[model samples]
Target: MELSNLTGFLVHRTDVKMTNFFTKILKQYEVTPEQWGILLVLDTERATSQKELAEAIDRDQTTVVRMIYSLEKKEIVRRIQNEADKRSHNLFLSDKGMSLKTKLMPIVKAAHDHVTKYLSDDEIQQLHEILSKLYATVKDE
Candidate 1:
């Protein structure tokens, strides 16, 4: 068992590489891959509470709060008080965020395509299925 052949090592290495690539592509927008993930989720789930956002993004609440604050400061996200919960806020993408998302969507797609350029569609699908299974197996452990 070489370190290079370890499942965790390989998956982590791939994640780091992909994160770096996404960070480079998003540098001009002043957005990190983590922030991009938040924005991506918000694009589909509007007025999501911070808790919901954290769950959706698979991040801890504290980290998600910090990311939300950064995005809010950039005018990319807006947090409105939750009517049902005084201590919680629902997050939404600002108009600027929506515009940014529109621009980023294609670029992100291109990035994905670039990364998987060598893989056939079936291979990509299989890869996703395998990854999802791995994720599920480790999620609670």
Candidate 2:
């Protein structure tokens, strides 16, 4: 196989492994990977509409809505009607969600560190850039 093909195969394998590891770790917090993604995004962006979250996370609206409902039921998130746009509801992390984010951030960081341990700092930087470029390419399609 060509180098590119080999890299693609490794990427796929690594993604599966990473997902499994993350799922196990996040389970302790009673969160799935999808829920974690939403939490992380809300942590950084603060109050945002579900539509915005869906676009930012590159997930379908239906999937996002389902995740939102689950998180809301867990008291990890709350939906507030948009004052200006009655048709839209903005999502915000609840006190519980904020607490969870604070508690779980170190675990997330450690997982990331473990996964990238084999790469040198420069290689890690390059890898990020390459991945960003790849994402942009596909996002434009």
CA RMSD of all predictions = 1.4, 2.2
Least well predicted 10-residue stretch by lDDT in candidate 1: 38-47
User: Could you say which candidate leads in TM-score?
Assistant: 1
Off by over 4 Å in 2: 2-7
User: Residue 67 in candidate 2 has what lDDT?
Assistant: 94
Task: Show the colliding residue pairs in model 2.
Answer: none
- Give the local distance difference test score of model 2: 0.88
Please provide, for model 2 over 68-125, each residue's C-alpha lDDT reduced to its tens digit, 9 standing for 90 to 100: 9999999999999999999999899998999999999999999889989999999999
Q: For model 1, how does the per-residue alpha-carbon lDDT over 1-141 read when each residue is reduced to its tens digit? A: 799989999999999999999999999999999998988888535688888889988999999999999999999998989889899998889989999999999999999999999999999999999999999999999
- Model 1 lDDT at residue 133: 98
CA lDDT, candidate 1, residue 98: 93
Regions more than 4 Å wrong, model 1: none
